[model samples]
Target: MASDTNELFPIPAYCKTIVGSEDGTIEDSPLQKLEISNPARILQLCEGLTDRTTKKLEIKINKYLQAETDASSVFMINLLTVSEEAMVQVVGDNILETSIRTPLSEDTISDIVEYKDNSLKCAEKLDPKLQTLINEIVTKDTGDLNIVPIVAKERRANIPKKTIVSPVYLVCFVNSSKDNRYITTLVHETFKYCLALLLNTRECEEERRLKQQCQSLLAVARKLFSHLGDLNDLLKEIMSEARRLTNAERCSLFLLDPDHMHLVAKVFDGMSPAEKNTEVRIAKDQGIAGHVAATGTILNIKNAYKHPLFYKGIDEATGFKTRNILCFPIRDEDTIVGVAQLCNKMDGHFDYFDEQVANAFSIYCGISIMHSLVYKRIQDAQARSQLSNELMMYHMQVSDQDVADVVTCPNSHDLPNFESFSFVPRRVFHRETPCFVLEMFERLDLIDHFRIKRDTLARFILYARKGYRDVPYHNWQHAFSVAHFAFLCLRNFQLVEKGYLSKLEALAYLISCLCHDIDHRGTTNAFQQQSNSVLASLYSSEGSVMERHHLSQTICTLNTEGCNFLESLSREDYIKCLDLIKNMILATDLAIHYKLHSRQLAMAQEGFTRSNPEHRYYLCSLLMTCADLSDQTKDWPETKKVAQLIYTEFFMQGDLERKMGKQPVDMMNREKASIPDHQLEFLTECCICIFRILSTIFPSAKTLVDSITRNIIAWESSKNVFDKLRVEGCTSYDVLISEELERQVQATLECMQDP
Candidate 1:
């Protein structure tokens, strides 16, 4: 029997089994007795019983006992007789009991049972009594059977109470044998161990399911946010996603209109297109959504109609019933941008878990709406830019007659000494500058080399002239003067011979010069940024607002009808020419001159070569800058005339700035401007440095440097005369530049001349 116990039962090495005496007195089994008395001690002993141990016990019992048995014999009777007569009598009896006690505590079991019963009644569409008594016979704490009454109360009652009873047993067996009691304890311990294993398995499964749900929600949100569409479509998708996430029948998205202190319903699901498009605005202080948006608080109302803050007007207007609502604030950073409202959850009512999911979804909603708004704004800006370009083309259109007039004009090869420092463009062109520009193109034979039409060149030139605004300094006249200087440089500097510029490069440079100052507002880049003008917003990051605007206008003009002069060039030449044109025009911005001039000067010292594209472009930019500021390199009379015109444009901007409640800079304010002093500073800092750098690369330009030096001397002499007049109480610029002083300045300039 001892060998059979070791082989069949296989009790663990750590466990000791006690055999009761026939007389029912086992004095040496203290631990066994304690386990019988304390159910918790039984749990500790049963902790080590794995599935292998339980199976072994089951096999051993099945070998000794009958396979079929009554509940009383299996659960209550504790002793099994191994005699042949007892075995033959109970052979085919089922030994394993079908009934088992749950592992939950008595109070927890009572709560669950009551909830189950109420749920079943609700499912059956039956209203159970408010208080119902369920009588049950259960084992007491002392292991004694007792009759207890359990009462089930209303589920939603504020103070609903339940009376709990321990688990009930259906059958019982009376046995005075101590061996039977010990066997009963062993069977109960095994049952407790199995129950604990089942509970742990269930808990693990539930945790895994919850994790999967969270991951699924996040994946859905990622897919929704990845959608790039207009704002209205994005809003509709967001509302649809919100409804899906919360299992809500309907959803609406309300945007906070801070400007008007209103919460506007921007998107509402479960509505026709016409109804959704209807604008519905509610005060920020009213309605559940309004409250959430204003306070940035989440509201999960189980019964929205019962809440005082719930506004019923929306439901009435939409012809829909509102039962429950989950309203969450949509926040961008710390600011509440909007609100998302979900109504009538499919599952009885919204719970805390629904609130959590809605809150998470709202975060994605806020980000998506922000991106959509930005996308819409970009589309609107693009539309406006296209419209502006169309308007520009419309007003600046060059008629065929205008083109024919300029193209048919008699071409003259003896135009003027356009490269001379004393040459005056206003007198040389004789107010027919467009015709002279066409003659220059004809002289260069550009029309035949590029296969360009005479009408196209004429139209482009005329359109470019018209592109310049009526500003005093940066107007059509200034544009023509710059283009003229570029032409003179290309013609006389032997640029092609020195490998500095090709004919194509000269054409791009001249065109870039003509279009460099188009549509000038007479205000500086600093003024544009300070005022936050539209041009500033568009081009401030590139650091040359007006220059970029000029480039844009140039492209728009070239795209106009009959103005695309480069259309006949090969694809490669067209692309290269356009790139050179863009670079040259942008280079005219004085803000970048110091860097470009320094780079070119260093390259020139290293023996500049046009083979390197970078070095060639640097020289091109340098030439464009010099042409832009060519007024400072002219004779004294031409220099003074250009200076007065520039100062007039500056003073006009200064007066406008004052009207706009901004203080003008010292150079712009007419009251503070000293003409001779300003001219001296510009000559020393800007004009002289430019020409000096150019002379290093092209020694032929040294004459232009000498011309700028002589002009500087004239400005110095004029400053001295002005200082003397100021000391003599002449306050006005007109009084300071008296006839005597002018004649003196002229005499000094004549003496300093190259002749």
Candidate 2:
């Protein structure tokens, strides 16, 4: 299957051999009796009217067309929309080459002056011989270019009575072609590619212009920044650049004086140099500038003298009449800082297009006005970069021998439960877990398929192991378990084979599962509020603090020297993979998972399409969460041990919270917490509910549901033990309940054996 639709574009098809019929006997006719026709005209589509811009395009199409037909040009060229997609006709005697008349006739001038609104009508209005060209072009797919051969009786002028069956071949410039097609296919197919190139060229030119404008804006910003220490120089520079960009005869930069409720500017463009330093003030509601400053609105007035908001006192004092004005409020976010007013536009009046240019310029003006703090922010950003580099020193590189230690693929038979969803990852030694990860990569051929260098892949695996802090349930052991679950789901369910996931998505899934809890503090999101670290400060306000930290740690590893496994991917694919990893890891947060999972489940019940990106995202999130909580799907003994470990960390946090005069939640408070109740509630609401959803989407996951149900039974039995012991005056019964559960499993298996 194709990786993407773009990869499928240029595969050519020569359908004539398969779809064409064999009806007539082939014959070789004399060269003089044959004539080949090529309708190689072009119609450019944009906003302008210069058709000659396509003259070179027309010649190229004609050349390719002749190669297709083995013939000469037959039809005339008529194209439009070449000038930014426009139709501009070159008039005078040159246009009448259709007849080559000597002096210009009145009818010819009238024809030159006449205009048609659209392309179809214009094609019909062209020379009458090829009037059907446009209609023919619209009827066929432009890419399915085909040539047709026609036979007709031709007689020379010397012997006008004799009839001869000569052929005229109509050739189109497709990479391949079909027969018995109309001339319209030839017309559109030739013009389609040529005009498309012109359109691309036009887009490039537009991009160049935008880059030039950006460079100019940057230059203006630099000049203004240099003058920040001197308000006089800064104000003068701001007014000069603003006036030049908007094409105004005079301009003023007015600062909002909040204390006195007036607009002030130290420099005015229309005043003499001697008066330039004098401050000008107007009431907050007096003139156009004042209105803009007060209300924070941009206004372009065509006739300034007639507007009701116009204040004529300044014009009367300066003895200069203001014919037009464009006034805009300069802002720092929502707060109005100043107003830029332009008077008497040099070209007609100011327009909306001018407003856009001035608005961009206003950003620098606002920066100049607010320079007291922005310069410090720029310096702080640079310092942040240096600090980020220093932090990277902790993400150490794995030695070559460390990579070689795990690089050898392990035997599948020796690695029991390696591919099983019910596998207990904590049983495997922490150092050996990286070997299993490497084996899984080799099992899926991820290293070879994604162009990941062998050493880079191994170093990344080692880096991931080290990135995790040693915690009760959120460390390297938990990370490897989650990743192993993802690996099984991918391999067993035929997710890639059935098109539910792409290779990039599967790669991201495994990576996210392995690194989702990196550097986790073994507590809740409380660290984000209580700690003052850089990671918390960067991601705290965004919410999903712990999940975001996991993603950041994953990125930091990839950005390290030898652990950069994703460097071989193209820019687009690399970005898409990173985005997928971020979203999937973040979705491991239960709140985010529920929001998208429910909506996606509703849609899936209706009908699911893996092709839809939103559906795929939801599916990936569900898988990530399932992988995260995968221990609930293991055997009863493992599940019991996992619960004890989770509560072990919880009780530790509760003890610390109590010491700090804080009330810990019941689940974490060892004295108040009932293990059976909390265990049952979590199983019923989170574990069982999630596994049921997974089974609904992928039936192979039904085994996970069975394991959860068995665990729920164990929790219920524990509840019974707790209630009985409490009545008998014993408070601790959790371990006794686990032993009883083991007894029940053994008895049930023996009874099945007897049957």
Candidate 3:
């Protein structure tokens, strides 16, 4: 009866039998399967065990085995329910004579207890160590086998009501046997699957974490690339991001100070704010960061204390203990601009990944740093330029005492009528030229009407006088004379009353006259351009070299603290005044004079009015030109004196030109000059035309034209006598007939003068 029962329920082919030895050893027997007399019925039963069901069962078995405390024992338990009753069985070499059975109505615990009792009985025949481990597992509660509870629930859901069902868990035991290697292999293989599943889950989580870290790195890179600020702020942000990215406890960003060939710590995140600013500099070949900067290489050191190139001075100074270091160079193009040094990592020592991230971040750091450095340099240069301008203004400022002297000087009430042909400014004002200017301002009521500050006006006049170079013709005296001529035009022509010029225009005209030739170098525009002087280079493109320089110098003088007389004007009025002054002064350029004169003549033909800006500009230019050459319209003695002074200036320029290997023009060359002939040409071509245009504008200015015409006649007579003397073999006019010519010219001038 026993042989018949064993053949009917043979062990499955997948099951292996463990044979026990007498010396407490267990060995694996050959696999065998029970013969099914009805092969078709066995195949039908196997079809019910699908791959999904088998996988779930395997997972449950592995979970239970892993939960067991004993490493030597593996358990495989299968629970089957048939006809409202459940059967529990352990799949192994040993099998109970009767399967543990319980009613479906009763709890599954009864079936599990019955199975444990049967498993203990079978374990007694195995090796002592294996038997002991099984006994412990069966007797003890071993806590609830909660592993794969979801799989248990899933299997329970699949069971049909009132039908046979089986839930299987396989367990294996490895005993202390010399020939139990196969059993040990089975045990290890089962646990290896569980470990692999656990490892796979952990790897997914690690992958997610790495992706997040990469995103963070990308964000940091974007911010660093777009960073636009000063160097200090940028460096601090870079170091902070580097520390956070690499999980470093401390970070230092050092810039290569190319000037000193040293590494300077621009930012030290580990240091306190007070200590951060402390100067930290290292030679380019000295330390780790310096080495990186010098060599442009990345250094990942596991232990900074162990590295020979590690710099410990900063650590000592800051009370920071650095365990590891990751240093890399920051590069702009091919040049290394700085280095980033990361100290001990928070979690572990710096690794290759950290080094790679630092290397990538340094690229953006270098660009940001380079941009910040360039920006800082630009700001510094602008500050220096502003400071230089301020210093220039400071030096050019007029003193308070000089201003006080001019303001306090007695006003000359007995000033000559500047509009008269015989008006001599040098004879009238004498040494009190500035005083006469003040009286003119007072006579025009400009000091009150324009809200001019007395001290500022006085300072302006004194500074204007001082601004003139000690040239032969275009000096302080000449400036004063031109100003007097402008004043004469203002007073005599009724320009302001007749609405030909506004009060502001009149004031600008006078101021322009005073400052037009403030810093004359006794050289013409052509001479300045030919010599390529500083003034010419500055204003040559604008077409009025000396005139523009004079205007610039005038602006500089007015900018002086005590000499800014026009400061009282409203913003609009001030701008208009400056514009008028610019136009009036620039018109003094002879190159511009003909254009202005033509424009004025056209405007005069079209009925010019002060309300028209173009007409006003044309008139202002004409007035400035007329005043500039007013000496030509003076009496013969004054005209003759001016001509001599002008010739002296021309001769000096000619000498300079000859020394520079340049040919002097006819008027400028002393050796080639005929004074009388040059004077005749100047009066006809320049002076007479200027007076003729002015006479057309202001009919009262005809007297100026008449005076200039009479001077031209006097020059013509002198030229005739000079020609006669030259033909008569008189080699020199000074030695022969000079007295006679002087007497003749003096009689002609005395008759022409207003008596």
Candidate 4:
């Protein structure tokens, strides 16, 4: 049976001579020599061969030289050597040897490579002889053997066509004895390995492609943020970049509503604006995008329809069918703000590659959006600063002159006793009146109303020096301007006898203006109320933020300092002062703005006509109101500054209202046209109102009013110019209060020194 099989397995050309070496000997039967050019050729030959011949070839090659033979037989042994199987053993052994490894050093390399394949690990046992052999083999550059394994598989593939050639290929490295099972596998096992290799190669290519796409997406996202002007531009750029990188049919971005629990589709592509109008809503954990957002993780869906949570409503509405989705959450550091999703990938269904790309995209989007928000905040803060500076110059200009002059008063006697007033308490007797009033005025800086007759003369200098650090609009400067205006109005009222001053009314106007906005935080009353801040809680949210706390702080500071101003007052006068202060401070609230303006207008229409106490009292109240908004009569820079502060307060209130889930009033609505227009309209009204009031009260104010009117008109002309043109809009930080404004606002200490 063996002889018949040998005849049936025709001897290959290279094997014929080796079989002829010995006569009539079983070993003389040509030890099948399978010679191939390379490892790849081995795969081809294995495909054509049968199962049984491959085994016989392995046995014949092994017996060619059972022990060291003559040099004459060297060619026979080399030709018959089917060592392709050894390459597999080498690879397998290498995997194991390196698997249980230490660092690769010169000493370790030799032992690791040349060690015998006895199936024993380094931990089990050590053969000194085998270890020594391994050292020498690794150290020496044994030529040909290093290149020997490349041909091993080839030789196995080249067996004679007559023999039942198996698919298995034997591979061996000539130099090392580390791997002994050269060609051990049958054809079936080889096929399995090839399949696995194909799968692994495909995965590697996919991983590389995914990484490249991710890198590209990130680059585009960063560029978009640096130039984004508003939320609309931001969303558009995001959508464009996402589609570009993913090569998808469509891409969408959804932001978490301010409540932060639901996703609202803010931007999308391949959809009409009308359809996109109603933002898509989903729970944080709802769909693939929502799931990613809720968990702040990457989500990969191979089939959208297969997903239980893939809301089909989106498909029906957009008339777009989605098969696969790659979604990732956009996070601002640790907080998930929104999610991004890509649909209908251009290539094969979205997989791990798409997931990786989406993740990278999300990172860039998150970082850029955060930077834009911060930039916007900085711009707002800068605008507020400039506004404060303008107010400062206006305040200083008015404070330096005589308040009686600016308001156009005819009398010189009742003008505040500027020459006799002393800020310091020189004697115990002086502390009760002059000393006390001076001290409050110094802290508040209310001396500005007396100086500037020109409508261009601004007030509110304290705000410029202090800026928006501790307080918002209500600061030392605002308090001072209010007091000065109040005092002048008080004197004018008494002169006209529109109302009576018993000592109480005089002191009350002074006190109220000084303390109205003390300890302000440059934010808003609503902020205090919404935050339920300690100030709000302590005052019981009973009135506006500053107005509510003004009285309490004034009383506390007065009591703590133990000023004697009230000691001389009769009970009636003291009560009257308290009442006046409370009423004036409460009037600062915008909620009562219309009423206050109407009453002031009514008094102005009454004319500087009557010389009675009742008429004088009405004039006093009217003048106080004028002083509150006197910024309009200030110089260009100062007036603009005051206006800016008021605007900031308004915008900040809008922001707070939005955050608290309340609808914004007027320009505060979450729409584009509402903000700047609202600001301009209100400011224009104020300019007209202030101009009219000043014209009525101070006849000399005509030139000042004309100048102010020109500036106001100039602002209207540009639509971009600030009431004061430092750089134009508060947004332009390049321009600031002119050097002249700065110098004018820095009042001479000499004037304040006496009172």
Best-performing candidate as measured by TM-score: 1
Better of 1 and 3 by lDDT: 3
TM-score of 3: 0.48
TM-score of each: 0.55, 0.51, 0.48, 0.34
User: Mind giving the per-residue lDDT tens digits that candidate 2 earns over 1-755?
Assistant: 54454333322232122211253322233321211222212222222323444334334445545545433332222321111111111111122222111122224222422321122223334443222432333244434333332223345576678964432212223323323232333433444335455444545655775687788889999898998765667888888888877778988888888888889887888798888757778888877888888777788887888899887887898899999898998887658888998888786667554677788888888877789345545654664565457545655657888988777645443466667786677888777888788877878778889888888888898988888776787878889889999999999887787889998899999999999998787878774466445555556546787888788778988987888999999999999999999999999998787777677667557665877877888789889989999999997778877887888778777787787788889888877778878888998988888888788888789999988887777667666566666667653325433466457654554454594
Q: Which 10 successive residues of model 2 have the least lDDT summed?
A: 84-93
Give the residue spans of candidate 2 off by over 4 A: 1-397, 409-414, 530-534, 724-755
Ranking by lDDT: 3, 2, 1, 4
Residue lDDT tens for model 1, 23-128: 4433444343334433333343345434333223333333322111112222221111111000011111333332111122233333333322122221133112
Compute the lDDT for candidate 1. 0.67
Misplaced by over 4 Å in model 4 are 1-211, 218-222, 225-231, 257-264, 274-288, 346-348, 390-755
Model 4: residue 9 alpha-carbon error in angstroms: 13
66: Cα error in model 4, Å: 39
Give lDDT tens digits, candidate 3, residues 639-677: 877877888888899999999999998777866678888
RMSD (Å) per prediction: 21.5, 28.3, 25.8, 23.1
